[model samples]
Target chain A: MMLFFKECRKILFSLTFLIYLVAVIGFYITQFSHDAEEKISQPMQGCEDYGTIAKEVPELLMPEAAEGLVTEYLSGYYTAYPIGFYKEVKLSEKKSAKIAEIITEITGISKRELDGFSDFDEEGITMIPDGNGGYTPVVKEATLPEINIPDTMTYERFRELMRKADKIIGGGSQYSDDNIVGNFSLVPKTYEDALAEYNDIFEKDKITGAYARLFCDYMGIIVSILPVFAAAALANADRKSRMEHLIYTRKISSVKLVLTRFSALAATLAVPVILLAFIASFSVAKLYPENNTDFLAIPKMSVGWLLPNIMFSTALGMALTEISSQLMAVFVQGALWFGSIMRDTELTGDIGRFTLVCRHNSLYDRNAFMENFNEFLFNRIFYTVLAFIIIALTIWIYSEKRKGGLNVIRKNIIGKSKA
Target chain B: MEKIEIKNVNKYYGKKHALKNITLTIDQGMFGLLGRNGAGKTTLMKTLAGLHQKKNGSITICGIPVENTTEIRSITGYLPQEFSMYPNMNVYEALDYLGTLSGMTRSERKKRIDILLKKVNLTEHQHKKVKALSGGMKRRLGIAQALLHDPKVLIVDEPTAGLDPEERIRFRNLLTDAAEERIVILSTHIVGDIEASCEDIAIMNDGKILWKGTVSELINNARGNVFTVNVPQKYLSQIRKNYIVTGMLIQGDYSTVRIVSDAVPDLQGINTDEPNCEDAYMYCLYQNGCEVQGGDE
Candidate 1:
């Protein structure tokens, strides 16, 4: 342990990780082009346009008769369903139809023929009115021809079916009599009809948050992990030059070597991550004031959520690097951690949840930092344990491999004892 | 005095035999392990250093089993065949860092760093990164680093491989100086290094040592049987086919050849004398049932 500490001081403390800190911090703070721009282009009115179509169809069909049903359906559908950008590329009609059938089979909706619909143009979207003044979809509202089925199908399947029906509806012009009677003049007659629609997803007036802040927090995660790469480079620096044979043969044990190298590397990652977390928090609070920014709260999240995760990631990287080629090991682990950050939203269903990179980061929950210091401490403990476990596993694998090759214990003691 | 004992060492890298039935004992003072490339010299060194495990063998340095690698390593300094050091570190920094790893205190590391820097003649470039050093300086650095902890045993594999003749001589002198107090085992394909510096040497091939003893003993053992013949250049190949040609030199239109024989050649008058370590090395290799047929037998 003493020897490990000594080595860490010399190799890990060298000015190697400085570059990584800058890069990670730079990446996070840099302005990213977002898919939200598409939302911005369409505006908040488009959301209302969708809501308007659902509400007005039945009212237009029966002027004074059935107001409650149309409003209820409109409120229930729009309020209940959350909107998100679909990631999958547009599928062929046949593939889309097959997927739709599979979904409808389990959804209990009668298979409705999609005669005319436009997937792209929001203007093309329209609702069919029931003779009783309730709104229904004009084309196949559901893909199957009805049998009771559960609604467990994913949103992806639903969106795919919607897209398929939209293509057919836009290609031709056919509305059932029920839909024809409720046709809304406020809505477009074709795909080009609704040029200006209101967005109901998240109101533009109620800015949820600044993207720059999220961008900065993301950079903090990357910066904090820089030490790991620096440590890895230093750890293998000796090995690359053939000094490992000499160094290992010294009083240093394989386990000590592994730990020392990990410490240096992990510390290297921590320095920048911690600093950037504070900076990001401060920047968000000061620069983007419209969002009621909390600079003090923001820095806490960086230390809490981002730092530990970076350490764990760096530990994992160093451990692999110890056992394998340094370049390849760092590359694989770095890419994995990066992927975890980028895919965090998709993986956890919430961008705020702990990703592989953010699992133990000290810079996570800003609110926890100020309001519940104990909770903040608790969160730190929770993530620190998680990070420690991963780091421990990395050390175990590394030492085991360095002792001989992989499966050293199995090969040396176990096999020998068995024999 | 400490001794390194290799007992029936057999190493297998997943069934590809590397070292086979190797048994030897090395004591304090200079020793040479000579072999061609891929002849298991490195395997033997690695096994002794505890870098590689032997399938069946017990190696003990100074009565401590080689499996007690950490303890053995504490007293042993090894320079590998292809040594590498941290390129990003300057000469002083690399030595200081390695010194710390070898269990030297910071003050002790600092003291040793100065001594090593001067010893290797790298004092001027003490602040220069390792990557900027010349090959000779790097080898010198390898030597200095290996000796830093003042280890009881020093194992250097192919130490003079890429060094210029002057550097090789200087390094041999350094090894000879260090060997005065420690067990220094130098493995190399060069016969001159063994002949000049090693008091005792072992010649290994095909994973086994064919012969081992002092250079004088190796030469003395093959003394009487060597002969020289002056033959036409055209018939040199024919004579070589019939006799083991140990040395050859073209003199005018005639070729002078040295060969080992139990009896005088049938061709009549020819001068003959004692053989050197090189001849003894060739003779020992051939005598150990090498597939290469002997001419002038």
Candidate 2:
């Protein structure tokens, strides 16, 4: 316990901890604070916009998905999220013919017409006169072609054809079963839908519950990756100070020393995030004074939602840094954070089992979060367990380092560098 | 207490053998290991501290085997050849942190830190940040940290390498005081430290011990082999090509060079001189044919 506090004090005085604090606070301020300044109001009977919701209805989805497939077929390339980053997938003429055949089977459009439309100037960025001498670039949104699915085609059959089209586009496309409904099944909200969502904030969320989701959404982005710097810096601190030998020769067992240091790092890095959680919950309470608010809503939610990200990144950072004696942790965690956040374009609630940064970017989407609550729980639990596993590996690595067991590895690395 | 017994210890860093079939017994007192850089003195020290594993050997420190690392570590402390604490921590804070790592209780840490700070003569600088300390002050703090737990053995590698003459003497005196009750192994390339502080010393070169005995025994062994010869400046280079010139005093066109040769030098005005630790070490290295080139430096 004393060593834990000492290690925490050491990290608290480090420049990396300061950088971590500034990053989380800066993210909360820039991304979430101003956007949520105005409190949510009751929905009136007749507003022009009530926002959009995704629902799986066969009639609406069939035409829309068919039109989307035809449009991408005409665009000469497909946009896919193969591993999370946006990928523009271009198919060979042979594979393009396969997709055209699937499009024909679903939309009753001929394959020759799809090939003929290739030279057509479809919607894209076009340069226009800005009234000055310079040209202004304007984005023209892509309009899905009007393609009608025959009445003889079943919705299940249409889905299978879409699956075939996704496989042709190299998977992770909107046509895949995992994403088809989320992508093409959206419908605008009705008056009752909007009003019910507004009341759910009061009855279900208790006002602060809704705001807590938004808080984690914004804080999760920076928290997932920023903690890597702290973990890596802490892991490298002893050697940087030329104190590795002095500390290694001590009477403390490697298990106790490694675990104490890890706990301290995890706690210190969590300080700013937990502080901001309190501030966010208090802010929501102040905003909705007449209603009840769970003051611990953000704090509780952050523990389940954001804490895994903090622990996972930090443990992996320490393990990688200890194993390689380099900042490989930063690159690996950064890639995970990036891929988890970019796995889907719809930001409100589309949690995957492996999403490191599970996001619910809106205040009123309590239902969306609740719908995927089980998967969210799994993701958090998986990361939490993974953090421990990696930390155990870190303890082993540290023990080996103490006993000069890593000299063979270090020598090989040095020998390779020299060669 | 049982002596630290190391029997036929061999270690390797990859294919290159670091400590080759080394065997020694170190008892309570100041024991000096004199060697040049890369002589595996640090390796031997680390192995004794349980910070390194020997390939195939047995080591028992104070009746506990080195394989029992936690027990060995509890009884032993190590200060590496190059070390400093977290630069931002004050002197007292630095010592306390190390004491904590040594598994001392809070009150125990406080008491030991106070005693060590006074012993190392750094009590006045207790509140100063480690970054603000001088090189010698940092070295003293290193010693303080190593001795924080009051271990049975303290292995300090090259403790006075970069200290000024005065600081070196003070550091050596501190080591001598530390050796009163426990074994303190001081490893260094500087032979003067061993001659001043150690009753027993070992000379190592290329991971092999060339000689191990008392300080005077080593000097006596090299007595007849050490000679000072007056040679012309033009012939100095030629003389160096034949012998290991340990020291030289240039005087106009002539120079008095201290050379270590197995036999009498075939030069004018050659006189046998008493061998100091440095001359004895050079003579030992030259007799063992271990490339003891000491000219023009």
Which portions of model 2 show Cα errors greater than 4 Å?
A70-117, A120-146, A160-172, A325-327, A340-344, A407-419, B230-235, B250-255
What's the CA RMSD for each of the models?
A: 12.4, 3.7
- The residue pairs that clash in candidate 2, if any, are none
- Over B123-179, each residue of candidate 1 has an lDDT whose tens digit, in order, gives 999999989998899999999999998889899999999899999999999999889
Question: What global local distance difference test value does model 1 have?
Answer: 0.61
lDDT of each: 0.61, 0.86
lDDT of 1 by residue, A335-401 (tens): 7556555441212112222234322222212221122335335544655676577667766765454
Candidate 2 per-residue lDDT, tens place, B1-297, comes to 647888999998779899989888888999999998999999999999888899998989998999998899888878898898889999999989988888889999999999999999999999999999999999999999988999899899999888999999999999999999999999999988999999988888888888899999988989999999888899988988888899999999999999999989998899999998899888888888898777844
User: Where is model 2 chain A poorest over a 10-residue stretch in terms of lDDT?
Assistant: A113-122
Candidate 1 regions exceeding 4 Å error are A1-19, A32-216, A220-232, A280-296, A334-354, A357-390, A397-419, B262-268, B292-297
lDDT for each residue of candidate 2 in A13-36, tens digit (9 for 90 to 100):
898888887778888889888755
